[model samples]
Target: MPDTEQLTTTTPNVQTDAPSLPNLEQESWQQLASAADSEADPFKTLVVATCTNTGAGARMVVLRQVDVIRKYLWFHTDARSEKVIQLEAFPTATLLFWDDKQQRQLRLVVETRLHTDDYVADDQWHTLGLGSRKIYLSERKPGSEQPAPYQGFPEQLGENLPTKEESEAGRKNFAVIECRTLSMEYLHLSRKGQTRALFQYEPESKQVWLAP
Candidate 1:
C-alpha cells in the first residue's frame, strides 16, 4: 500500500492560495441567514456559552437573526431563564458552531444585551409562530420543580395552536438577546489537513490565518 501524504505542516498566518478571511465571514453569514430553511446549515442550532458567578453557563439556542454588515446575531429566550440573569451580569458570551459534514467549527466572541421590553423584542416576538410562542406561556417559571415531569405549557393546551389572544400572554416572558460579534475563529478539520483563521470585527476589522 502507498503512504498517504499529510498536509498539516503548512505554516500558520500565511495568506497563500487558501480561502480569504472575508470569504469565510461571508460564508458564515450565508449559513446563518439560510439556517432557518436549510438543514445543511448546522448554525441553525449553536451552543451559547456565557460567564456566571460560579463558572461557565452554556446552552443550545436557535439562531434567530443575522446582520452581515453590522456583525450582529440575535436569539430569543425566556426572560426568566438563568442564562438571561447570567448575561445581565456578564454581558459577554461565546457562540460555538459545528458542521459535521464539513468538519468545521466556528467560535464567535460577542457582547450581549437583553431586550425584553423594547421594540426589538416586540418585533421579534411578532414574527414568532404559535408553536414557538407556546414556549413562553408556561404556567410556572422555568426550571421549577414538579412532582412529575411537566410539559412547560398548560396541559389543556396540549399540542393545539394557541389563539392570537392567548398567545399574547407569552409576550411578557419572551425576550430577544442582541449579540454584537467582536471576533470569529474558524477551524476546518480533515484527514488530509486542517485550516484555521481568525476574523476580528470590532475595534478594527482584520483577518489573519491562525495556528491550528
Candidate 2:
C-alpha cells in the first residue's frame, strides 16, 4: 500500500507555510470581492442571518456586490419579504460564506440598511435582468400561505422571461440591502492544520489569530 501520510503532505491544497496576519486578511477580502464578480465562485452564494422577534432567521442570498475598500456588501430582496421586515427591526445581521474548493469560511458581522424607492435601489434594479426581475412581480407577498403550489411570478409567463416593460412592475417590490461590515472571522480547514483569524473594522481596527 502507498504511504497515506506522505500523500496527505503532498496534497496541493495543503498549506506549506504559515501566512502573516496582514497577508491573510488581504487574501480574505480579495476572495470576497472576486466572488461578487464571478457567478461560478462558490462563495457567491452566502447565508444572511438576522434576529427575529422570537428567535433568529437565516437564508441563502446571492452576492450582488462588494466594496473591499469601504468593507460594504450588497444583496437584493423583496421589500415585502420577512427578511426586509426583520432587518428594519434589527439592523444588525451576520453573513456566512463558505468556499468548498478553497476550504475557507468567512463569518461577517454587519449593519444593514434598506434602500427602496431610492437611487441605490434603482441602480441595482437596472442591473438585474428580466429573469431576476420576474420574482418581484408576484402579486402575493413572500411567505404568504397559498392554496396550491405557485411560482413566485405570474403563472402565464411560465418559463418565459418578462419584457423590460413588463418587468418594470416589479420595481416597487425590489429592494437593495446594503451591509456595512463591522467585523469578519476567517477559518481555513486543511488536513495539515486549521487556521483562524478575526478582523474588526468598527469601534477600532484590529486583527488577531485565534486558536483553531
- On TM-score, the candidate that comes out on top is 2
Q: Top lDDT: which candidate number?
A: 2
TM-score of each: 0.89, 0.92
- The per-model lDDT (C-alpha) reads 0.88, 0.93
Q: Which residues of candidate 1, in runs, are more than 4 Å off? A: 1-17, 36-40
lDDT of 1 by residue, 1-212 (tens): 77688657665454465677788778877777788555467888999999998899899999888887788899999998999999999998999999899898989999999999989999999999899999999988888789999999989999898998999999999999999999999999976668888988888888988778
- For model 2, residues 150-212, the per-residue Cα lDDT tens digits are 899998999999999999999999999999999999999988899989999998999988877
- Candidate 1 residue pairs that clash: none
Span of 10 residues, lowest total lDDT, candidate 2: 6-15
Name the lDDT of candidate 2. 0.93
TM-score, predicted candidate 2 vs. hidden true structure: 0.92
